[model samples]
Every structure is written in C-alpha cells, then in structure tokens.
Target: MKATVYEGPRSVAVKEVPDARIERPTDVLVRITTTNICGSDLHMYEGRTDFEEGRIFGHENMGEVVAVGDGVDRVRVGDLVCLPFNISCGFCRNCEKGLTAFCLTTPDNPKMAGAAYGFADMGPYDGGQAELLRVPYGDHNCLVLPEEARERQSDYVMLSDIFPTGWHATQLACVQPGDTVVIYGAGPVGLMAALSATLKSASKIMVVDRHPDRLALAEEIGAIPIDDSKVSPVDQVNEQTDGLGADRGCECVGYQAHDPQGHEHPNLTLNNLVQSVKFTGTIGVVGVFIPQDPGSPDKLYKEGEIAFDYGLLWFKGQTIGNGQANIKAYNRQLCGLIQAGKAKPSWIVSHELPLDKAPEGYQHFDARDNGWTKVLMHPDGGSHN
Candidate 1:
C-alpha cells in the first residue's frame, strides 16, 4: 500500500507502506477511494503538533469495503461506507450518549478521552490516506452509503468530517430558524457552518475572513462576507445586525488564528466572537485547539492558555460551547440531506488529485494558496473521480 506520510515541517511524501488489514473481529478493511486533506491535517503537516513521522495523514475518508470481520453484522463486504474521523467504541459511555468524539474507550491514554485517525496524541489508529484502511468497530464506525455514493464521492466524503462538524457548530450555538449568525473563518469548516446555518433558516449569515477566495465562496452561498483584512470584523458584524450584533456566533479558526501580518494569536477569534455576538447570545467553537504549542513565540500560547476576554464574556451573559464534533451524531442526518439533493458540500472542493499527488496537494493547501479551498485525493488514481 501507498500512503501520504508526514516527513517533517511543511513536508510529506506518498510512498509504499505496510498493508493495512483487519486486526480484530470487529474490524473492516476498506479500499479507500476518496479521502480529503483537511485543514486540521495542516497542524501536523506544519509541525505544530507532535505527529510522528511515517504516520498516514487522512481522516476524511469514504470507500468500498473489501472485507468485513465476523463480528461486523451491519456493514458488509462490497458496501460503500464513510468512516468518521473519530475512532470510537460505540458501546462506551460517551458514545452511548452521542458524544462519540469523546469516547472513553478508544484512546490509548486514559487521560485523553477522544481519538482520531492519524492525528497526533489521538491514538494508534492509521488513517485512510492510502489504498487500504483497517476500520475498528466496523459496524459502529462505518456509515454505509447509498448506491449513489459511488458517483457522489466528493459530497459523501464530507460526511466523514467537515459537514457534520459544521452542523455541530450550529447545534452548539443553538442556531434558531430566524436567528442571525456570524462565523469566524471562511475555511471549509467555517463555510460548512454557514451552509448549516442557511439550512436551518438563519435570517442572516455573516462570515468573517481575510481570504478573498474563501469570502467569495461564502458570498456565493448568500452569506454576507465581512473581509476582516479591510475593516474591523466586529464593526461589520455589528453594523449588519443594526448594532445589536449577531444572535449567534461560531469560531472555526482555532489556535491558528492570526492577523493579516502573519502574527499568530491563539485568542484572536475567541475575542472576536465575544465582541461580534450580541449580549446573551451563544457561541459555538469547532476549531482545533491543542493543549500545548512548544514552538509558539507567545508565552501564553506556549502553555495552551489564551488571554480571552472572559470578563466581557461573563458581563455579556453569553453561553459558550467548545469541543470536537461527534461525527456520528450528525453524519446520518447530513447524509440524508445530501441524498435528497438538498446539500452539496462538494462546491467547496478546489482540487482533485490522485494519491501520488498528495504531497503537492498538502504543499498548496498548507500554504493557504489562493484557490485551494479543499483538496480531495483519489487513492485509486482518479478512478473514483
């Protein structure tokens, strides 16, 4: 098998690796067809995280099941399935409560409650950025796709992560049908939040970001794009809401939030969300915030502490929700929307390349290069495309 392996800071290589096979009775072997290079993957790619070299690098995955373990009763060989980024044991307490992202039984370390494929500090599970993926808890982790998924891999592939994560942001923010919502960042997850807000009938959707390409995509989806590079995002959001601020807010940039000058400020988006959301409004954060950043120049960020405006947050009486999205919690409903032709997340995809081109895709995406909104890799060398 061949996989995209993390080489070092801003580097990756696609090369032959040991084949992934069923290691347990509950495991399922998938012939990976479509996998995405997610924004979060950049954390490892940029050496911001302690991701080990030689580890595969993908989580957004969907493909055909080539083999299934005896214990897998629901998923079968030949079934097309989408594997959620989270590697959870469905019978765990957290998973039973639909908090699969924080499943207590998956992580190798007892202190860590959640696990993800190919993610640093998550678990030992290999990712599906290759020709084969060994899925644990097959019946529980695999979301069997409809027959049409074979042709709509790009859209369905999103079910593995971003789409559900975006929807989870809306849920955390408690976005009401007529509520006005503002989201920070215009990356894939942010755009998905905007899309989720739209589907939930948000009266007004405002997305704050500096990237012209990303902001343009938000505008195309009927969201009012607030170019923070040109003006104060808080002011724009306030002005659009007639000085009341948005009814709900979402933070999608996480610890990598920074200014136009390229100076990283981990607290930037949190403070912005506090100011842009109205008093008493709620905010949902789906961005990836690590516990530590040893390479950070900022003292507070080095310790994974942000000097957030907690005083103002409390004064405003705003409710804040932050965590990883439990992909299993929303994938089914989101998948239904896709199957019904109501959602098309594939609109965000800007690059489709074969598995061998993964390093190029990572380079362009990690640079945040213009026009690279999302990159989807076909492990079968464009056969799925």
Candidate 2:
C-alpha cells in the first residue's frame, strides 16, 4: 500500500508501505475512501512535534469496512463508517463516562491518557491516509454512517474530526441560544465553530483572522469577519459587542498562532480571547497547545509555557475550558444534522486530490496558499459530493 510518510521538516512522500491488516481480535480492516489533511497534521509536517520519520500522518478518516475480527459484532463488512481521531477501548472508565478522548486503554504511555492515529506521542496506531487502515477495538471506534453516506463523503468525513471538534469548542465555551459569541481564527476548525454557533442560534457571531479567504467563509455563514490585519481583533470584538465584550469566546488557532507579519506568538490567541470575552463569560480553547514546543521562537515556548494575561482573567472572573475534543460525545448528533440536510461542513473544503497527491496538498496547506482552506484525499478515486 502507498502511504504518506513523514520524511522530515516540511516534507512528505508517498511511499509503498506494507499493507495494513487486522492485528487483533477486536480489530477491523477498513478500505479507506476519504481522509483529510488536518491543520494539526501541519504541526508534525513542520517538524514541531517528535513525530517519527516513517509514520503515517492522518487522523481524519472514513471508509467502508472491508474486514472485521470475530470479536466485532456490531460492525460488519461493507458498512460505511467514520472513525473518530481518538482510538479508545469502550470498557475503560473514561469511555464509560463519554470522555473517550482520554481513554486509559489506548495509550501505551502510563502518563498519557489519550491516543490518536498517526499523531505525535499519541499511540502506535497507523492512520487512514492510505488504501487500508487497521482499526483497533472496531466495535467501539467505528461510527457507522447512514445509507446516504456514499453520496456525501466529503461532509460525512468531517464527522471524524473537525465537525465534532468545532462543536466541542462551543460546548466548552457554554454557548447558549441567542448568546453572542466571538471566535479567534478562521481556519477550518474556527469556521466550523462559527457554523456550530449558527446552528445553536447565536445572536451574534464574530470571527477573527488575517486571511481574507477564511474570513470570507465565516461571513458566508452569517458570522461577522474581523480582519486583524487592518484593526485590533480585541477592539473589534469589543466594538461588536458594544464594549461589553462577547458573551462567549473560542480559541481555535492553538500555539502556532502568528501575527499578520508572520511572527509566531504562543500566547497570542489566549490573551486575545481573555480580553475579548466579557467579564464572567466562558471561553473554550480547542486549539492544540503542546506540552513542549522545541521549534518556537519564544524561549518560554521551548518548555511549552505561555505567558498570557492570567491576572486579568482572574480579575474578570472568566472561566476557561481547554482540551482535546471528545469527538464521540458529539459525532452522532452532528451526523444526524448532516443526514437531515441542516448542516454542511464540507463548504470549507477547497481541494480534493487523489491519494498520491497528498504531498502537494500538504505543501499548499502548510503555506496557507490562496484558496487552500481544506484538502480531502480520496484513496480510491471515488467521487466526492
């Protein structure tokens, strides 16, 4: 099988690798149809993380089950399914409580509670960016899609990660119906956050970013776009909310956040969120903030430390929620919205290429090239709607 292997910093190659097959009684082998190149994957692509050179690099995946282990009872061959980025055993204590992202059974490291396929320091599981993927604990990990899944692979594939993750951001911020919400970053996840807020009936939605294309996408979905390059994002958010600040805020840019001049600031979005959200308001941070950032320009970031305005956060009595999204918690409901034609997260997709073209997709997305908002790869060259 040909898989996208991480070669080094800002480099990837489509290399012929050994076929992925069922390795355990609980495993399911899937013939991957659609997979995504996520922004988080860029962290590894840029050599920011300790990702191994030979490892595959995709976590957003969906496909048809080609084979299943004897222990798998619920999933069957020929069933179209979308696998969550997190791989968890259903019987773990965390899994029982719907905290599948922090499941105790998947991670090999005793100190780490969560595991993701092809992610740095997550686990040993290979990703679904190739022709085949071996899914562990298949009965628990696979979210079976509806009969209409094949026609909407581009949309349904999002249920694997960004869709649920964006919804999770709103859940963390405690976004209520008719509440005013401000979101930082207009990337795919941030755009999805705006979409989620719209579906939840937010009275006002403001999205901040320097990219004109991304901000335009947010505006297309009824969100007010704040171009930080032209105006201070903090001032814009305050101005939009009549100086009271937004009722809720979300941080979707993570640690790789930068100014319009291309200077990286590890704490840029957090401080922006703290200052933009009203007193006593809630904030949710779903962006990836690693424990250590060896490649960051800031000295403090070398140790994964960010110096944000925590004093003001305390004085304002604002609450913050941060972590990886428990995708299983929201995927089912989000999938229902897609099936009912109420939501179409695929609107952000900007490119669709064959599996062999993944390296090109990664290069363009990494550069944040014009019109390269999102890229989906089809391993089987299947038509995507």
In candidate 1, what residue range of length 10 has the lowest lDDT sum? 376-385
What's the CA error at residue 37 for candidate 2, in Å? Answer: 0.5
Q: Would you list the clashing residue pairs of candidate 1?
A: none
Q: Which tens-of-lDDT digit does each residue in 132-233 have in candidate 1? A: 999999999999999988999999999999999999999999999999999999999999999999999999999999999999999998999998889999
In model 2, what are the clashing residue pairs, if there are any?
A: none
lDDT of candidates 1 onward, in order: 0.94, 0.95
User: Model 2, range 189-281, lDDT digits (tens) per residue?
Assistant: 999999999999999999999899999999999999999999999999889899999999999999999998999999999999999999999
Runs with alpha carbons beyond 4 Å of true place in candidate 2: none
